[model samples]
Target chain A: MGRWQPGARERLEQAALDLFLDQGFTETTVPQITARAGLTTRTFFRHFADKREVLFAGEESVPERVARLMAEAPPSLGPMELIAEGLAPAAAEIFEGRSLDYLLRRRAAIDAEPALRERELRKFSLMSEALEQGFRDRGVDDLTARLAAEIAVTTFRIAVARWLDQHGDPDLPATINQTLAAMRHLTSHGGCSPFLTTHDEDHHRRDTGQLHDG
Target chain B: MGRWQPGARERLEQAALDLFLDQGFTETTVPQITARAGLTTRTFFRHFADKREVLFAGEESVPERVARLMAEAPPSLGPMELIAEGLAPAAAEIFEGRSLDYLLRRRAAIDAEPALRERELRKFSLMSEALEQGFRDRGVDDLTARLAAEIAVTTFRIAVARWLDQHGDPDLPATINQTLAAMRHLTSHGGCSPFLTTHDEDHHRRDTGQLHDG
Candidate 1:
């Protein structure tokens, strides 16, 4: 019986998450996920390599999309702003077809499973790597680019956490913006002259020149 | 033969790293490590649960020490500064009695294996958790405390990588300071008003009162 539905992949993921949440990730099996989705195990295999991959498949394309967003963003934007713009597409895409309840369930499953958590962190690490490369491509100093990428990713994690915690449907972009501002606040000196004031002019001038060339 | 040396644990770790590098992490066995250290298998078991434990044993105590440093740091120091202070002891302790060569080799062994890489990242995650708890204990706001801890840990990680890379024996503390300064430079806006200016004054006043009470 060769049967593959139009929404087989989404149905499989939704079914897998429901099963994982109903019992536990370790107890959930491919047959069970397929049964719940009203599909064959063969169809499930076609979509995901394994149960773990089901939760992580969405994250693979995220880095490429984010890097592209940053690369195409207006040159006048600062590194932090550019990163925020890059993250917007990811936020929208990840939560696009999923309901709030479905996302929460998915997050809960991930949280309850150590294997899933590791995969999640690894994906975030990959995203940071992509972001760092994007910054280097844009001619930012190596150290600054790396540090900025780390900060932006960290802020994104916090924003996602906050977005999930809200009682009602949350505004992910606004929450991310807030998280970025909070990160800036956490790192800033209290009422003191800005850090690296003397180097600012040279850095910005170089940044402008690079942007023009790009 | 029951020949257990004075610094059996350190000797075992050194032996393990050598074996790991000479062969590979997965190929190197408990007997090889013990034999290289001139110790019994029992001694290795007494020291570590397994070969992987040799690389991660010290991380368990790190959060406690770092949190203590942060809690006792001068009240006048800002949150970011306090976190840097908190991380100083960790840098010293990690490199204590370890040669630059030893550190590099240990890192190489860890890098060579995916299992070790996951362990390393998990340890870093634990460090961030500890730092966040320490900040909360110090009465910093939740979001700010969490973000501050993350930035500090990230900067520390970069510092460690850089310290390991330098040809000349580098000072870990100074490297950490440099990384912190670099992070500040990345986050700070040029000549703009400070982030959380009013909040800083209020937080400091409360912090001072808490210090006096302590």
Candidate 2:
């Protein structure tokens, strides 16, 4: 009825990720992960359904979680406004408590495997669909809802990517905000030179309450 | 290397599509497809590498084709400008001569199968990568190149979906243009009500040469 080991799941995950990094994903086995985790194979099976299954579902129900967060948002906010003010924060918060290094390792694992990559893409696709439905339920028009949802997911993707690149700031929320600004700027101005504008300037402006909350 | 039957490829494709629709993708085989088209299995093998292969590559090398077209585009165009003016037109032209009905059938077969859907997504993913590289080759910065490329794919996806919905007009290039206008307006204006404004209005405006070729 409960996790008897308390942290057995996390330990197994960490050990598997390390093994995936060191010995390769296909080369790693369940018993190997269990031994590395100092847990039994039974415990590993209890934590994960199978080997590839462990490659994902670290944040299982992610799409539903995002949709649930957006559901609590104000109904009056427009598509872009909801995305920037609502979904961005929610998305950033979802990954806030997790270890950035662990995330980077997880990303490497997914990236190295085509099957895992497809599964990741499918999860994001589902998230987009959920967000689209949330916007529609919030009274946004059809096309705008679809556009907003797609852009929301895209913004999350780009923001997380930039954050994980490791050369930039480690603040995930700021990176998310910065990514939203970049999207709005690119779409609005149709220019590329000003893309070099630092997120700090936009961050300061947003701090002064300059959001277009239509 | 020249085909003895000039129409053999098209016949195999169409017959395979029809069979996939009638008897389902798994149920239909190469022999059945050839039989339906009054051709030999040799001809089928000559065309498609396998059964699932027919489910995709109706326009094989699409990403390369797009990147090649964009390679010839002027370097002065901004990211969004290149996408809207250069890439959109090029994408539309690539699908211009094909029959919409055949394309619709192909879409159905792909959508009906998860493997096919993932393959389709992978193709589009490759297309986005190709487009991103094209923008970078033109000297656009990294982030903007990614945004432009991703948005280009998204716009193409939405426009084609609307076009295939078959409720409205069938001129795909115009639909592509309309999608661009919508993206710009959404990003620039941040409002949802005006999304109801028909593409015809923007069509007339573009017809009058109001393009922002930044």
Candidate 3:
């Protein structure tokens, strides 16, 4: 019951994760988590609303951090670069120092649990919303802001996938930067297709004639 | 019993949506839906496993249709163009001709219900997976495929939002095309930031020197 002490939440989280891995998410109980953490059920409840909450305790802070970072970024950086800078701290602080085995196991646990996956998706949605708002605040237009934010989220998700799959090689930030660069290349070169350039020409030619009927 | 005949599923869906809107999702019962639809509970069960399934009845077809469209796209079209073509049908089929009032109310109901929202997100994730697989089947690399599919989803979502918000202005296909074009501009100009061009120059300079450690 005295688990209000510093680091008690961390202990509870680690214990809950271990139990969820050893047994299963549904099979793991609050009492089991408390006992493993050397705490009590009361302490467990105080730290987390439920066992699942343990895995996502600090997630709410992510949007705020990303938004703040984006807001603080220098104006000279491009929208994509600003987003990259915004996410740099999260990549370093949350994903760094975690062993590959731990990350993969944690990912497995999350994948195996539907509720956790839903929660993760919700988190991603929230992050995207925050990023979109950040871009809008910087005077970007509505559609442009939304696209940039969504693309940034996609970049982050792909980078995380590569990082998790490849044992966190080159670190999260580097992977994200590389992924963004690839997207830039893909979009800029029109996927390097002459057919695309021809279509673009036709689209532009018709743009003044029929497309702006809006 | 006669509910097993034509359009029974659609009747059940319309009834469920009405009941959900009037009495709330949690308050609405299967019996209530059947009563409203002038059918039996057995018929309801035959059409849907439960009430929530009504809103998502035909959604399972979305991924298959999108994937099939992507697979059939001409190789001359680039990745983004292929995706845009894939989604052109959905914009016309699902969103066109729907009254703004009806669309807004439907969106409100889904937004108000947590379970429905979660189900929607899960459906989006599944669609992304199918699209990614479609790209992979066409010989795109893993990360590139994922990025293209995710970005396509982003384009679809943003276009839908605009359509829903502005009473389907510019129509669905046009909105999607415009959104994609904006993304193309954003990526090509690199947000028109001088800092980015310099970085790109440096990146090119170092491309053969130190970046290939990848």
Residue-level error in angstroms, candidate 3, position A128: 1.0
The digit string of per-residue lDDT tens for model 1 on B99-131 reads 788878889999898888887887888888888
DockQ of the candidate models in sequence: 0.31, 0.53, 0.53
True contacts kept of 1: 0.48
lDDT of each: 0.77, 0.76, 0.76
Judged by DockQ cut-offs, is candidate 2 incorrect, acceptable, medium or high?
Answer: medium
Candidate 3 positional error at A136, Å: 1.8
Tens digit of lDDT per residue, candidate 1, span A1-214? 5565898888888889888988999999999999999999888888788999997756778888877877888766657657656676767776687777877888899999988988887888888898889887877777778887898789888888888899334588888888876676556543122342444434434632433434
Ten-residue stretch with the least lDDT total in model 1 chain B: B188-197
Which residue pairs show collisions in model 1? none
TM-score of chain B of each: 0.82, 0.82, 0.82
For model 2 chain A, the run of ten residues with the poorest summed lDDT: A203-212
Per-residue lDDT tens digits of candidate 3, residues A114-178? 99999889888998899899898887777778888888788887888898888878877788888
Residue A151 lDDT (model 3): 80
TM-score of each: 0.84, 0.83, 0.86
Ranking by TM-score: 3, 1, 2
lDDT tens digits by residue: candidate 3, B1-214: 4534677887887788888888899999999999998888888888788888888777788888777777778866767667657677865665544566767777778988989988888888988898889888887877778888787777777778787887878777888888777887666554544233666646633531324544
